[model samples]
Target: MEYKYNKNEKTAYQKGYRVTKEGIVIGKKKNPVGWLHTNGYRRFKIRDHEGKNRNVGVHRLQAYQKYGEKLYQEGYMVRHLDNDCTNNHYDNIDIGTASQNAHDVESERRKERAIHASSFIKKHNHEEVKAFHEKYGSYKKTMEHFNISSKGTLSYILNKES
Candidate 1:
């Protein structure tokens, strides 16, 4: 079944239970504070369905950490070894800690930066980097787009439309 996006709300019915995109009412499926989601429907998390927050993707990773093993399709991070999130093939998915996952992402970012930097340096006639700010499209937009916590990484990439 196709999954739909659901906004979160302060559901009063349960402490941790929340609605999901599949219309299930999952509650505390797995967690100390009891992470909740709608039952039957495994499309979304309670927080996503009920919480009115813009930074949804920030903590969404945690839900995978909290309930990945218990949830269907979403189990084991469903990582795309090739770096595509939508590629849910079983061969691509694997269980890993958030920090570890972040490490993988960082490694990919570094590789991408290296490759892109080389191209930029060569194609742009060595005038690729212009004080960092201009090339990265401002620090705020860069961080938000990358879902990054550390602004310390000296990595760079061309935010191109693939």
Candidate 2:
């Protein structure tokens, strides 16, 4: 699944739009749109070489401005170094493969799972988990009984008080 480079979008960016280091896109008139996409990335409406309005991501635009068209031509995706979709700063973004992007997403998922486990642990102590485990008589059943999602979380809960 390779994505072809969008020359129209690139041309639109190069025509009169400028991206600040903070990821702000300024049009020809130097007006900031300050629009955000539903996925949290900065969005901009610009006219392409064909004079058609097009929506573009600030990260991609910044990457193009900083690294030129080679990235797009090579099928590399713009990735946020800090795994934040909203932080479009030029220095914080880079070009990477789709697999790398998927790894970044997995990293974010791990962080979310950790946060959820932490909150869950705070609400339910080790004694409760132990009692559930004893009644269930199996790790899988114990996890299901307590709504736990992973064996690592169950192990952590069981060992926290030891």
Compare the candidates by lDDT and give the number of the best one.
Answer: 2
Model 2: per-residue Cα lDDT over 2-50, one tens digit each: 5555654477576778789997888888888658778788777877767
lDDT of 2 at 144: 80
Report the CA-based lDDT of candidate 2 relative to the real structure. 0.75
Which tens-of-lDDT digit does each residue in 1-162 have in candidate 1?
432333232231234644233223344654222223233112333334445432222123333333442323321333334454433334444554444465556666756655654453444522333335466767666545444334333243333322
Which residue ranges in model 2 land beyond 4 Å of their true spot?
1-5, 105-162
Candidate 2 pairs with clashing backbones: none
Q: How many steric overlaps are in each model, in order?
A: 17, 0
lDDT against the true structure, per candidate, is: 0.39, 0.75
Error of 1 at 73 (Å): 16
Tell me the spans in candidate 1 whose CA falls farther than 4 Å from its real position: 1-78, 105-108, 111-148, 151-162
